[model samples]
Target: MTQYHFISGLPRAGSTLLSALLRQNPAVRAGIVSPVGSLVAAVLKDMGPDNETSLFLDEAQRAALLRGLFDSYYGALPPGTAVFDTNRGWTGRLDLLARLFPDCRVICCVRPVPWIIDSVERLIRRNVFEVSKIFGSDVGGTAYSRAELMMAPSGLIGFPLNAMKQAMHGDHSARLLLLPYDTLAEHPQETLAAVYEFCGLPPFKHDVDDIAFDAGEFDARLGTPGLHAVRPQARREVRETILPPDLWARWEGASVWRDPAFHRRVAVGGTPGADHGTAAG
Candidate 1:
């Protein structure tokens, strides 16, 4: 049987890198955001009261249909392969997932909110000639406006962050393993070992220094060329902030997972010591 797990959390965090590294394990299958989550959502919507034909369906039928989506999508994989479906929406759908795959776990990659914004800004600046679809149809906007847009409740960064926070405080929090971006970048080996342990899988040697991943076509469609690209080496690159000081200050301490109280509520990976002190920037 194929084991199913999930990868979710804030954008611009280390999900792309995590996926790249996980793929190094021959028994694992992972990649950039998959459409499976959205398909699951569509199936649920179609089975909801809003749909005229939904009244004919029972809980068992609905569950079977949902499970079939995964089986069909990954049917070609060998029976024992572990499939890590990447989607930010997964955090919010834990209730449904619990019913579908009780033993599955979600690995949420997170980072300081300010740095997330800065990373997106950096990408926008690097691709100056192309107006990113990240901003929708708006072709022009200042840094502040762009920040405000992304910080909206349903915006790219906002939705996943909110979903993660909700999951952290909810009943399914135990199924989540929060991995900080800084820790993964700075300590790839230790992070991967922890991830394997969390998933109950035996460890596999990974060539972290030669990690490779890119989603050029997907990124091109978004008008953001390198959105899902991962550098060959897995190491943190220190750089000065490109955001204005005031903008940086606005979001600097917004990483909720860094809070001591957060560790008390759920399991966290990559932090040093038993107390789970703040992760390095």
Candidate 2:
């Protein structure tokens, strides 16, 4: 059986960053999203009058479509390597992933609700046009409201996140690791050590002794291609401006960010792997 680590979370909770870090380890092969599925769905749009794609595709065709998606992703990965895919709102389809890889370790990354909302708001302000260029008609005709997107019936971000939490509370806790974003921000090495253990990977030695994790501008040199490229300044703006002051209270009591040590890191530049959470969902 292949070992797979599923980085499941709401958008803007640092799934990209976490996936990038995990991918750096030689044992892991990260699977990022491709535009092929959406692209294919769009070209077939004219074929249907209403939302009747199901009528076009027979049972075998439907199965083939899903298979193409899986194959497109898995075919790129090296044999015997653990695969990691960091997609938001992936918890709802947990069983689907389980069937794909029987041995799976899920890392459900989470941030405070307020911060996540704020990040979504920022993404709406800046990235909508850029994202739409790729997703195009698949994203819907008119622009979507961030609030409505968050509370969508399909569980866009918040509710699905809560569902993940509930799963952790149930029988899945042994396989599901609830990693707070704040915890990672403060002590990346320590937190990542725990994650590596959970994923059954050998821990790498920590080189930086006095390093602090800062979500500020990352190293321009450590180019991990598309995964590491995120707008941290935009993230900070949303965290400071968009999220209401009231919401901070909910996370302020938590041990990671609320505690003095973590606060100190936030006040100063944090450690080696410091990451800024972006507004994306």
Candidate 3:
């Protein structure tokens, strides 16, 4: 009986690293972001009340159809294994997700806003020879300008933060578990321990230092090689600041997790919701 779960949150916030480590568990299947969530959304809208086909199905039928779609998508995996669906949009659709799978848990991987912005900028600068397929060839501007474009209210990297914030305040927040990027990079055992427990799974050994993931296909298409590369050990990148001093200062005080209310207290088998593994609702 395969169970469903979600992995999402801020971009460059270690979700990729987390996924790599998660796949270490033989009973767990996780990978790069999947299109299932988007497909679910499309199916729902198309079968919504306005659609003629919707009238043929009642509440139970609709529910069964949606659930079946997931089963069919992940049907190739071995039985009795838990499925983790990765997508930044999951944080934005907590309510819908909860209603769809009452027992499902959402694991959000997050990091400081300033650092998240800095990471993307660093990637852009490193790949000077190759135009980033993510930002497109016309990333035409200074490092600071590019940062602004990526952090603005409607920026590509900015939307996930806002969406996660909204879910934190939403009614279904109890199903969410927040994993700070630093924690996973610095202390993976404890981080993954809490995740497994929250999702109602028994303990399984995870070789944090023996992790590996090859994102060659998507990375090449995105024009951002090594985007999902993970080192064997969990360690933070140590290097000089690529962004200018003034530019760095722009996002100096953007660590939302620093707030007393957002403090993470995830221990083994930690409960979900605002005060525990989840963000305040």
Largest TM-score belongs to which candidate?
A: 1
Q: Is candidate 1 or candidate 3 better by TM-score?
A: 1
In candidate 2, which residue ranges exceed 4 Å CA deviation?
34-72, 96-100, 126-145, 205-228, 231-239, 244-281
Candidate 3 residue spans exceeding 4 A from truth: 262-281
**RMSD (Å) of each candidate, 1 decimal:** 3.0, 10.0, 5.1
lDDT of 3 by residue, 1-281 (tens): 88899998878878888889889888999998887888888988988878987889887887788888889899998888898999988888888778888899998887766667667776777887777766656757777778777776667667777777788777877777877777777678888888988899988888887888999889878877777878889876645556666776776555554464763434222322212122211
Best candidate, lDDT: 1
**Top-down lDDT ranking:** 1, 3, 2
Report the Cα lDDT for residue 8, model 1. 97
**In model 1, which residue pairs have backbone atoms overlapping below 3 Å?**
none
Q: Which has the higher TM-score value, candidate number 1 or candidate number 2?
A: 1
Q: Each prediction's Cα lDDT score? A: 0.85, 0.51, 0.76
Writing each residue's lDDT as its tens digit, candidate 2 over 219-267 gives 2122211223443221232234454454434433322433444322221
Q: What lDDT is reached at residue 69 by model 1?
A: 98
lDDT for 29 in candidate 1 is 99
List of clashing residue pairs for candidate 3: none
Report the C-alpha lDDT of model 1 over 192-265, residue by residue, as the tens digit.
Answer: 89888888888998999898787999999999999998999998877767788888777666677777676534
Report how far residue 281 has shifted in candidate 1, in Å: 15
